[model samples]
Target: MGGLEEWKVLGGEGDQAFPCLEKLSIQWCGKLKSIQVLFPALKELTLSGMGGLEEWIVAGGEGDQVFPCLEKLSIERCGKLKSILICGLSSLVEFGIEKCDELRYLSGEFHGFTSLQLLRIQDCEKLESIPSVQHCTTLVELNIRSCRELITIHGDFRELRSSLKKLVIGNCRLGALPSGLQCCTSLEELWIVSWGELIHINDLQELSSLRRLSINGCDKLISIDWLGLRQLRYLVKLTIMWCRSLSYFPEEDCMGSLTQLRELDIGGFSKELEAFPAGLVNSFQHPNLSGSLESLWIYGWDKLKSIPHQLQHLTALKGGGATIASDLESIGNEIAKKCGGLPLLAKVLGGTLHGKQAQEWHLILNSRLWDTEDGNKALRVLRLSFDYLSSPTLKKCFAYCSIFPKDFRIEREELIQLWMAE
Candidate 1:
């Protein structure tokens, strides 16, 4: 609709009436200023790239229950849009707005949607505030990202702590969490990010149901209470990244109580971090780490090597032509478990047992090599040297080469030709 300045109506009298229409998408109608159509049965509505649109009000006036059955509403790239009202949309379940920079406010009581479960508002730079979800008891996921001007997340959450499973707030300037977030005991996954005024997450202790916690890019954040964190027995994955002011991590005694903890990551360009946990806690030990801790561990931005740099591609060893690709993979899995992310150990182990049977490799993997000090020393001493060639044919080749003068250097190509001729 390049020249079309308005969209007045849709569907016709008979078969074109769209009586069963469940979804409608309006896009690239730049001249369109208003959506003067309504679909009572529409379950989803998407409007995008309509540069002139200022407001979308369903055909009936303000008091009518317009879109009473709408389930999802998505608005994108309509920068001039100022308002959207879903006042009585009782069946609306999900609402999303993206790249609508001119959106000043969402004009509706979010509490009106009894079934609203997800609200995602992203990249709306001029948007100032959102209606509270304190009264919406079914809200499960709330994500607000890059709304730099957004300052308040209304405090009505405590009155009804619904089963909110995920909450993500990023790149905003809110100084603190909404007042009653501490009472959200059913929250499971939480992510707080960006250069916000929120200095600490000490208020989130009430999230007893939390399993994953990620805090990143908070430039002002300084400390975390690990003693409080140690009590979260169900916490599994913790990621703290790019928080330039954080200077402390959990003490060893607190670390010991995290038996259910699995993954821990910490990295940022902070000058205060000299030696991790060393100055943070009096003394720290790896033995204090929980047994169920399966995946990564990190501390300080400068001390740790990147994953891609340290864990080499297994195919690199195929260049040595010692083991074929398929066989090397089985060997790789076993070696990774024993070496604990040491590339040298994996490479040496792979080359050392190149031609060995699968059973032999498994036997070596099950050994106490990683536990005993002498065993670790033995591994450091071991190498995939040429003398260990188990094949008698290769051994004879080495012995026969001694027939030549001691200082004479033999070319491998000539040796292959001689062996083929024999």
Candidate 2:
């Protein structure tokens, strides 16, 4: 009935009891291993930093022993725990296990988890396959990240796909998406990142309900079938980055079917690309994009020379209602010379060059200083803004922005945290 705090256990002699406790957290109890019957009404339990604990139960002879009423459970960095006993917690809806290296198996059937909705497993290097979800129809979100040994999405994807709205698989060895993913009509957002062996994802076209899609660091991907994505009328954001084999964007009118597209990011082009696609800017003014397309980013085009005339059409759309933006900082001088110092290029470079040194500032505008001749004087004028950043802390914080990949918008809070962590 009352809040209990800072109770240290010297030895396992006393029979601790908290009948009214709904939340129990056990931390740093070096000698504690098996939890004796206590807190019968507990709804949430957290076990963290308990190094000496080995197993949840000592031996057999158990019938609904620990945490019978627990609905939420979390176990972090408990290296000695081999298996999590979920047989008794019928009321559990959310469960998380992280950094449990010794955990190799999750025993039991999904039929018992009638009330479960969210399950997360991360940094469990020993885990191989996820428990079959034949009966957990209530599950809405499943996140699996950094599970190096996990190789498959085992079991019937159709049964689990209908209820799952968000599925994220990152930093795993999954070579391909499960074939049953097409049955997931309710899926709204899907993200795949750093999957080394993933070569192609043709089944994504069937996910008509998808509203946001992102793919990054898929080095093996050589081509994308943009025609398959036109069916997603509700899709608002499409981002593709670090896909080295991708050399060109889709045809000029390829994305014309996505009427609701508000943002598009195609960055991390391989250094082999000599220039932007011929009709890239014209594609933005396609019938589908007339007044809808608002933001666009194209980065790492090493040999890009000038902005296409169609880009000027985007300026008209921006003047009318949309807000246009680009991350072509490297080609700012080329763009300035080609467009006769377009206001958009000047504005973007002004923000990117703010607080940078005279020489360093010149380098951003005149991308290849050793090869360019026209922008040396213009770059000198851009260095005047560097005097604004006088504080040591702020200077370090701004300099840290260099750590992020180009086109990345640094958040104010994240910048401060990175500064303080240093």
- lDDT to native, each model: 0.68, 0.66
Give the alpha carbon lDDT tens digit for every residue of 184-271 in model 2: 8888888887777787777667788888888888887766666677677888888887777766566556566788888776666556
Best by lDDT: 1
Per-model RMSD to reference: 19.5, 11.1
* Over 4 Å off, model 1: 10-17, 62-64, 248-254, 279-288, 297-299, 302-422
How well does each candidate superpose onto the true structure, as a TM-score? 0.66, 0.66
Clashes of each: 0, 0
lDDT for 365 (candidate 1): 71
The sequence of per-residue lDDT tens digits that candidate 1 reaches over residues 158-199 is 754756888899988887777787788888888888947867
Which run of 10 residues does model 2 get worst, by summed lDDT? 1-10
The 10 consecutive residues of candidate 1 with the worst lDDT sum are 310-319
